[model samples]
Target: MTPKVSIIVPCFNHAKYLNECVESVRNQSYTNWECIIVDDGSTDDTEAVSRTLESDRIRYIHQENRGLSGARNTGIKNASGEYILPLDADDTLNPLALEKMIAVLDQDPDTLIVFSDTVTFGHTSKKSNLQEKFTLKELLLGNKLYCTSLFPKKYFDEGIVYDEKLRHGFEDWEFWIQLISTHRKQPITKIDYPVFNYRSHPETSMIKEITGNTDKKEFIYHAVYEKHKALFHEFFPSYISLLNRKTFYEKKLESIYSSKPYRIYNFLINLFR
Candidate 1:
C-alpha cells in the first residue's frame, strides 16, 4: 500500500466555504489520503457541514477556540498519515496536487518538505509571492514556503510542531524556520507546477496585520528571533547590518514624507485624482 497522506483543514467560521474545501481533497487524483477538519469553536454551521462530509476516510473533530495554530495542532495530533499537508478552509488544491507531491515524497527521503507554486484566484488574481528556492539566510529573512507545503510526520515526532503562541500571525513562517533549523541536513524542494489554489478575498491575509501594525510586527519578529537565537547568532553581524539598513531607509522615507515638496506633490496627486 502507498503511504497515506493526511490533509488537515482548520476551519473557523468558514462554514460557507467548507463544502467546496472538502471536495477539493476528495477530488485529489491521489487516493490514499484522509481529510481531517478541525472546528475551532465556530458558532456558524461548521459542525452541520462537516458532519455531512464525514466518513471512514474523512474525519471531523471539534475544539474550543484555540486560534489557527491551536486548531492545526489539534488536527495534526489526530492525523494518521505518514505525511501531513495543511489546507485552509477558504483555499483549495489543484486536481494533481497530491499525485505530484506524493511522488516526490516517495522518491526523496532527504527532501523533508515539498511545496509547489501557487495559483491565486477569486476576487483578484496575482503571481505567487514565493520563489522556487531559498537558502537558510533567505528563509530566515522572509517566508519562502506556505502553510500548505507537504512535510513528513517525522519533523513533528522530533518535537517540532506549530508554535501556538504565534496567534498574532506569521506562524507558518516561524514554523518553517524552526523545522529547517532542526533538520538542517534535509532540504525543502519545490515543484514547478502551480497546484495550490489560493483565494484572494476581502478577509485578505492575516499576515497583512504585521505590515500595518508595527507593534504586532515587532512582537512576532522578536518572538521568532528569540526562539531561534542560535541561527541568528551564527549570522549576527550580517543580520544586524540588514536591520540597520532597513532602519536607515525607513527614516529616510519618513523625512521625505515630511518635506514640503513631498507634501505639495501628494496634494497635487490627490487633487488630480
Candidate 2:
C-alpha cells in the first residue's frame, strides 16, 4: 500500500497566495496525498478562499490566531498520514517533490528527514545550493533544512511540536535542532536539485525578523541558546565559548551602530549601495 503524505499549510492573512500554494500541491506528480489548510484567525478572505478548495483530499480548519507554530500544531493534530510536509502559505513545492522524497524514505528506513534545495522567487530569484550532507553541528550553527521537508509522523508521535513561544522568528531552526538532537544517529536526506520554491517579499516574516530591533533579536538568540543549553554543551562544547563571544561582539556592534557617528557613516554607505 502506498503511504499517504499530508501537506499541512498554516495560513495567516495569506489569502492572496493561498490559491497558488494549494494549486501547486494539487498539481503534484504524486497523487496519494492530502492538503490541510489551517487558517489562523485571518480577518481577510481566507475562509472563503479555503471553502472553495474543499474536497475529499483537501480540508480546511480554522482556529483563533495562535501564531505559525500553533497553526501548524492544529494541522498536525488533524492530519492522517504516515509522512508529513509543512508547506508555508506563500511557498510551493516542485511537482515531483513528494514522489522523490517518498522514494528516499521508502528505501532507507534509517532516514529521519528528507529535504531538497530551494529556488528563491518573488523579491529574489535564485537557486539555493545547500550542503548535500546533514550534520548536527552545522545545523546547530544555522538552519539548512527548509520547513517544507518531508518526515515521518514519528516526530509528532514523539511529542515534538514547533515552539510557539518563538513568535519572533527562528522557530523552525529551533525545532530542527530539537528534533535532530534526540535522534542523532538517524541520517537526513538532501536532494541535489531544487524541490521547493521559497517566496521572499517585503511583507514576509523573514524581512520583519531581519529588520527587527537588535536587542530583541539578541534576546531571542539567548533564549534559544538557554532552551537547548544542555544539547549544545553535550554535543559541541567548543560552541559555548564561541556563542559567548558572538553575543559580546553583537552587543558592541549594536552600541556602535547606535552612535551618532556610526549612524552618519551608515547613511553615507547606504547611499552608495
Candidate 3:
C-alpha cells in the first residue's frame, strides 16, 4: 500500500543533524509513512550517512545545490504519498506529530495545511512557541508555520512550486501566500502540542544568511517585503503605514554600513546570519 504520508527532508552540509532528524521520523508512533531525504548536493558526509539507513521506506535523492525552494520542489516531485510533510534537515518532529496530524486530516477532508507549535532549542535553552490559527495577513507579515507541518500533497501539485530563484529566503513565505490566495477557502488548523523541535545552530543557512553576511540581506529583506506587501496590507494596513514612513529598501541600500537597517533588524540579522 502507498504510505499515508511522505516526509521530505532537504539536506545541504548538515551531516551532523541529519541522523537525528531521521531517527525522529523512524521513531514516529505512526507507521504508515515514507521518508524521502533529498540530499541537495551537500559537500559533506550527509549522503553517506543517509545511505546507512536500511529501511525500505527510506528513499534518498541527490541533486545539485539548488536552494531550499528548489530542494523542496524536488521532494514534491518525487513524493508518492497522499500527504507531504517537509522537515528541515536540522530539525526533528515529535514522535506523535504524524499521528496527531493525520488524525486531524482524516477528520476533516477539506483541511489543506495542519501545523503545530514548536520547541526551539539553542545552546542551553529551549522555548515553545504556541501555534495559533493565523490569517493570511499574519502569515504574510510573519511566517508561523514550522517546517515540519503537514500539508496535502495535492496542494503542492496544484499550488505554486517553491520559487527557486529566491536563493536565500522568503520562498516559503511566497509559496504560502500563493496557496492562501489561490485556495483561499481551504481550512488551516493548529494542533496545541509542541510537535516540532527546531534546532538552533550557528551554521544553519538562515543564520549564516542574515548575520555573518550583510551583502545579500537587503535583497532578501525587500524580496520578502515586496512579495507579501499587498496581502499584508489587505489585512494589516497599519503595518504598511508604518513601513511606508520610510522605505526599507532605501534605508537598506543607503545604510550598507549601519549596524542595523531593518526595523526588525534582530530578526533579519538572525534569519540570514
- For each candidate in the order shown, give its overall lDDT on alpha carbons: 0.87, 0.86, 0.80
Residue 241 of model 1 has an lDDT of 69
By TM-score, the better pick of 1 and 3 is 1
Ranking by TM-score: 1, 2, 3
Candidate 2, RMSD to the unseen true structure: 3.8
Q: Please give, for residues 155-211, the per-residue lDDT of candidate 3 as tens digits.
A: 788756788878877677677777777778889888876777888765555756664
Give the Cα error of residue 257 in candidate 2, in Å.
13
Model 3, 251: alpha-carbon shift in Å?
Answer: 9.8
Kindly give the stretch of ten consecutive residues in candidate 2 with the minimal lDDT sum.
Answer: 202-211
Q: Which run of 10 residues does model 1 get worst, by summed lDDT?
A: 235-244
RMSD of 1: 3.3
**Candidate no. 2 TM-score:** 0.87
Give the better candidate number (1 or 3) by lDDT: 1
- Model 1 residue 183 lDDT score: 78
Model 3, 30: alpha-carbon shift in Å?
0.8
Count of clashing residue pairs in every prediction: 0, 0, 10
Which pairs of residues collide in model 1? none
